[model samples]
Target: MHPIAKSVPLRLLVLLSMLLAGCLAESEPVEVAGKCGPRDLTPECCLKQNPGQWEQCTGSTEMVETAKTAHSVATRVVAAGVTATVALQPRINSAEHRGAELAVDLLLRVDKAIAQCVRRAEREVNDYHFDGRSPSRELCQQLKVGEQTTWAAYLGLFKHEQAWPCLRKALDELLPKKNYLLHPRFRHDGQTGKWEFLDEQAVKKIVSEQGWKGLTGSIEPDIVILDEKGFIVHVYDLKFPCPETNVATWTRYKNETWKDWSQGDLYKTALGVTPKLVSPREGVVPETK
Candidate 1:
């Protein structure tokens, strides 16, 4: 290789190392809940559950992500404390403009603020990116990512109206892991109808009163599958925040909305349950304008 070419690869390696080992982070309150992604498997957790995930975790995206999740739970020494959620207020000229693209791509550093957020230890959310140029519903587009849809994020809380299905997926994904459930936090839309997770005070109440079963909400727990007799059996949906409400609040997104997190059960009925998950036939491409 030419001298310059040899140095080019070395320089690239050094820059990549910095991104993995030295990026600065700040905590915020908008963290979502139960954010177990493909990268959530910890070294021990990974090896214990399925070694393939850990051994194969070689890419930059996978390694950086796993270490981060493990750090959050590992950081909290005391069993109980004020719960925190990491939030990101992305400057979304249009949050739904992008089809299924992720939040990690931004040409500008300032835009980084809008990309990824390591929120409440319960859930990690990657904000959706639609358009930085404008916000118009004519630009109203479907924001999806496999099982998880990318609705325009409600700052500081889960997009409950759009978060239930994903939460169900989170529960299914993490169910086999014991520690993942021990000191769990519920992630859902908040009192303000935005992304948010369960507060510490509320979690203590669950343990003191309902125990893990209470982790399942008021809903009788039913799968959203459309197969004959339903695919899975029951699902006591998850709603973050507490259980109380103002009568008027019930009208905004219908009683089903997580507008008031204090309610006993937020999953009485699936809003968009049409037998099959109503997804587009084709993958979407978000417009940048």
Candidate 2:
């Protein structure tokens, strides 16, 4: 190798070593803005002092905040869009025009908020350093929740109205993972009336031909799991700020509220399986008999 080329590699190695040393030096304990007792450390301060606990605390906090912000922004955007669309109906006679107007209004209102949430979420995910790259799993999952929340809000607004079937396209975008009951499969046994898997194309065809009769209506679950026979194996209803801790609150969710809404029973009647409730905090509840 040429003399200059050999010297260049050595110089680069020394620079890299210096950069690593600087990072290590910067990791030393330092004061942060938050209040800290004489012997205590705030989470920010502890990041340098005790990185292990800091990782756990900060990771959990970030996840919780990311989920909350995503849900809140999604709810707000959808609600505003629905209200605006309703108000614009008299101004725009065509359904297409009203929907376009709603989309534009929502984009203007929430584009910045969504971008901020996405950036924060991406940063948190980058902190994990999985394989030296930020994993998309967490970010995508959060975004999916946001998408589902938006769709649910639209469903609520359009339910029992003429625009329902048009909005049902949102559900089609949220098909569950493969091997899960909700994912569309291609096989069915006609004789035993058991399906090896639910056919996505067939279901779409039915919806197109017959309307939203057997598929979905005003009352719907967050996720619908279908059996091989195209019957519902399980329905998942996601609840925000889950009612897990408070006994009285949980009682209302189980007895008075859900019972009156009959969402579970409605799914059962339509797809032959009772729905299960899910939450970010509590996860899936045990299936009720």
In order of listing, the candidates' clash counts read 26, 3
TM-score of each model, in listed order: 0.24, 0.26
Candidate 2's residue-wise lDDT over 1-289, tens digit each? 3322222222222212222222211111111122323344333333334433423434545433443443233322212112111111111112232111114453233223322332332233233223324333333223111122222222112111212222233323332222122112222244764323223444445445754332322232334433233334444544432112321112112222234434445444444454555433344554464
| Worst 10 contiguous positions by lDDT, candidate 1 | 242-251
Give the alpha carbon lDDT tens digit for every residue of 32-70 in model 1: 223334564423223323423433433345444544453
Which window of 10 residues has the lowest lDDT sum in candidate 2?
A: 83-92
How does each model score on lDDT? 0.25, 0.30
TM-score result, candidate 1: 0.24
Q: Which whole-number lDDT from 0 to 100 does residue 267 have in model 1? A: 25
- Runs of candidate 1 exceeding 4 Å displacement: 1-62, 65-131, 138-141, 153-213, 216-289
Model 2 residue pairs with clashes: 195-228, 195-229, 232-271
